[model samples]
Target: MSRRASGPTEGAVELRGIVKRFPGVLANDDVDFSVARGEVHALLGENGAGKTTLMSILSGAYRPDAGTVSVGGAAMSFKSPKQAIEAGIGMVHQHFRLVQPLSVAENVLLGAPSSFRLAGNATEDRVAELAEAYGIRVNPSAKIWQLSVGEQQRVEILKALFREARVLILDEPTAVLTPQEATHLFSIMRKIASEGRAVIFISHKLDEVMAVADRVTVLRAGRRVATLAIGDSDKSELAKLMVGREVMFRVARGDHEPGAPHLTVDGLAATGDLGLPALRDVTLEVRAGEILGVAGVAGNGQRELTEVIAGLRPATSGTVAIGDRDLSASAPAERIAAGLGYVPEDRLGTGLIPSLGCIDNVMLKRTDEF
Candidate 1:
C-alpha cells in the first residue's frame, strides 16, 4: 500500500475550488471541503444537492472538471479508485459490495496488500481483534449472506481498516441500521475518529448529524452554504441551511375510527433475493380508512413482504386478502385487476418509466381505460 505523509496537517483531506459538470448541469460548483484529523465531519444536503458528487470526486470515481485535491497537505490527482486507496483514502458506499458466498475474513483480505494478508485462522483472529477493539462484532467465518445489514457494514469497516485507510468516507452508513444498531455504529465511528483519522459522514438525517458529528457542512444547490461546529448549530439551523428556507415540523393525524379491514395478511412467508426466508409467518392488517405502518431495519423482509402482497413474488405460504378476496396465488396483473393498487420502493425504475411522459406512464396499468 502507498503511504501518505507521516504527521498531522491542517487538513487531512481537502478539496479547493472543485467543480464538476455534466452536459447542461453543474453537479458541483466550486465547492470547498475539508476534514481534519481526529474529527468527525458530517456532510449534509438534500438529494441532488451535490454532496455525493463532491465525495465521488474525492473518491476518484469521477475526475473534476476543475479543482485541486490534497491529501495530508500534499496536492494530488487521483485517476482511479485504486489511486485514491493507495493515498490512504477509503469509501464505503451506501450500497455494499460484497461477495455473498465469501466469508467475512476473506472479504476483508480480498483486495488488501500482501502485508495485510494472513492465512485462514490468522485472518479470522485479526478480524475478531479488530471487531473487539472497534466495538463491532461479527463472525469472521460467516458468509456475507448469513449476516445482517449491520454485520455487512462492520465487514465494510474492517475492509477499510485492513487497507490502512487514514480517511474514511461513509455515505448513509446508518440507513439500513436499526435504532440500536445506529447507536452502535456511532460509537464505532467515534472510535475511528478518535484514533487520529478523518471520518466524513454523509447523511441527510439531521438527528443523526447532530448526534455523531463534531462539525457539520451543509450543501445547497451545489454550493457550500455553511460549515459550523456541532455545538454552534441546532436541527432547525441545519434544516434551514439545507432547504434555503425555514421549515415546519408538524404531523396531523386526526382521530377517526378505523373501518373494516381493507388489506390483511396472515401467516405470510416469503423469500428474499438471496433465497432466504426473509418474511416468516408475518401477519398484518390495514383497515379501510387507516394507514398501517410497517417499520423495521432494512433487510428485515419489508421489501419481500411488499413484493409478496403486490403479487410480484410467490409466497412460500400464506393468505393475502384485499377486502373479501384472497389473492395469494394471483399474479401481479391479476392482483391489479382485483383492485389492488401498488407502488414499489423504487419509484423511477419500478413505479414509472423514466423515458415516458406523465400521461403515458400513468396509462401503463390502465391501458384499456386510456
Candidate 2:
C-alpha cells in the first residue's frame, strides 16, 4: 500500500510496506504510515492490532522484516534506539523509564552525550527553560519518586524534547492522567506540532483523537484499514473502522434489587507510601448483587483503600466488615479465606507472576493444597 501523508507538508516520518514478525505472529503485515511536519496524527486500534509493534519498528526497538523508513524524505536505517534518537525520532512509552531516585533534570539528561561534562546547575536550568517553553509544569530539582504520575509524564516528554526529537511518538499518554492533565497534554502536543515537529499519538480514545488529531489512521489485525482527516470523520465511523464492525456506544443493563450489605467500610484512614495521609475518614458500603465504583484522581488513595481492605496495608483507623465479619485486622491469607478476592492494579507484578504459567500462577494462593 502507498503511504499517505497526514497533511500537505512533506513527511517528517514515514514507514513504507513495513513487515514485522514474531515467532508465530505477524505483528506488522505490510503496513504503511506517515506523519507530516506540523501534524498531530493519531493512531487507533484494538489490543494486539500491531500498533505498538509498528511504532516499535519506527522507534528502532525492532527491525522490520521488510520495509523502508524515511525521515524528512531521506531514506535511513536504524539499528538501535540511540540511532533513532540521533535521527530525531523519540518515543515515550506507556510505562516511564525514569530513575526513581534521580531528579527530573538528572533523569532527562541521564544518558545524553553532553551530560558527561560534570556541569553544576546547568542541567536543571536547561530543563526548566525547556519545560517553560513547552508549557510543561514540573520542578526540575524534584525527585521522580516525589512527583505525581502526571509530572513524571512531563519529565518523559522533556527527555524527548531535550534530545531534539523532531518526530515525537506518544503511546497511550493519557492513560494515567486526569481529565485536566490530559487537556494540558493536548495543548503541549499542539504546541510541539506548531513548532514544525510531528506528533504520532497512539491511543484507543476516539473522543480524544477527535479533539486533538488533524488526521487519524486505523489499523485492524496488523493491516492499515484507513486514514481519514479529522474533519471528514466522526466517532462512529472511526469506531467501525477500528474494529472492522459497528461498535455500540452504550449497552443495556438489567435492573436488579439490592440485597443485604456485603462489604462495608466506615471511617477508613490510611497513609500513602511517603507517610502522607492518603485516605481520611472515608466511608462506603456495597450491597449484595450490586456493583460499586470508586472514582478519584490518580494519587487519591484508591490504591490505599483497596490495600487496606485486602489486608495488604495497615489501616490507621477503620472498620471493614464483609457480611457481618470484621476482617480489617485479618491477614491477606485470612481475608482470602474469608471470601475476599483482591485483584491488584499491578496485575502482572502483584496479582500474578509473568514468568509463571497459568496453572502455576493459579496455584500460587493454594500452595498448601498441593
Candidate 3:
C-alpha cells in the first residue's frame, strides 16, 4: 500500500467548535471537522443542513459567528477568498464562475500572471500540457458555453491547479453532472488526492459519497452527527446518520399518468443580453409534478430558456404558453398565475432573498400577498 493509501495526508486542516448563525436559525453550531493531507474527505448532508455554511467559513466566504480555522497547525484568520488562495486553498462552487464566451485557459488564468500581459498562447499551451497530465481534457480555445457541464467542471478544477491550491474544496460538484461526467470527476479527484493534495467534497448523494470518500461525515440540522469510514459502512448506515432514521428514496408509480402540460414554450427564439441570438427556435413542454432535466452544456440555451419562461428575460420572438394561456407578452406575475414553477440557474441573483429565512424564502410570493 502507498503512504497516501493509509491515514490522513499531511497538510491537515482543523475546525474547532465553529458556530454560525443567521437570524432565527443556527446554521452551524459548534461544528468540528478536520481533513488530513491528501485525504478525499466527504461532507454529507441534506439540503440546508449547514454543510455549505461550514465550508464557506473555511473558504473565507463567510465569517463564523465563533470558531477557529487552523491549517497545518498554523493559526490564521481569512478575511476573503484571496487570503485563502494565498494560503493554497481553493473552492469550486456548483454554479461555475467561468465566463461562457471565454476560453478554458483564459478562465483558469483570469486573474493569474498579469492582467496587463497579453496572456499569449504560451499559457494555453502550458494549460494543455497540465490538463493532459491530470487526465482533465478541456479545449483551451473552446468557448465555455460550448462545453458540457462535466467539461466545464474540469475547467473549474484546472483553475484551482493554476492557482496552486493544495487544499481543494468542491461544493456539490456532481449536482449538475451526468453519470459519465461524474465518473470522470471522481477519477480526477482520486488522481489529485494520490498526488498528496487534500480534497474536501460536499455532496448530498450518499452513493457518490460512499463510492469516493475515505471518511464520510454526516451533518444534520447544522450539527455533525457521525463520521464513519467508507469501508465499514453501507448506504443504509450513512442514510441513517444523515437523517437520524431510515428514509425511502424510491417511490413506485401506478402507471404512465403524466397530466396535461403545465408549461409550454413553442418555437422560442431570443436575443441574448449582449444583443446576440441566444435561443434557436426551440420548442418544449413541461408537465406538473414532473422534473424536467434539461441536459446541455453551460450557457447554451438552457439558462436563456428558463429565464424567458420565468418572465425574467424577454424573448425576441416565440410564444411561451402556460396551460392554455399564451404568456409571451405577459409579465412574471401573469406567468405565475399560469402555473409556472421556475427555478432559475442563478438562484442567488434571481430566485431567493438573501435576508429571508428558508421557509420564508419559499413562501415569499404567496405568503406576502395573501
Which candidate number would show the highest lDDT if scored against the true structure? 2
Residue-level lDDT of model 1, residues 17-128, one tens digit each, is 9999977678899999999998889999998899889999998899999999999999989999888888889899999989999999999988776777787599889888
Residue 22 C-alpha lDDT in model 1: 77
Q: Cα lDDT of all candidates, in order?
A: 0.88, 0.90, 0.83
Residue 353 alpha-carbon offset, candidate 3, angstroms: 5.1
| Tens digit per residue, CA lDDT, model 3, 162-276 | 8778889999998777777788889888888877788899998988987888888889999999877788798888888888888777877566667889878899898787788
Residue range with the least summed lDDT across 10 consecutive positions in model 3: 111-120
The true-versus-predicted C-alpha distance at residue 272 of model 1, in Å, is 1.9
Name model 1 segments beyond 4 Å from true: 1-9, 22-25, 114-125, 337-339
lDDT ranking, high to low: 2, 1, 3
Residue 162 of model 2, lDDT score: 90
All candidates' TM-scores? 0.89, 0.83, 0.77
Every model's Cα RMSD, please?
Answer: 4.3, 4.3, 4.5
Which candidate would rank higher by TM-score, 1 or 3?
1
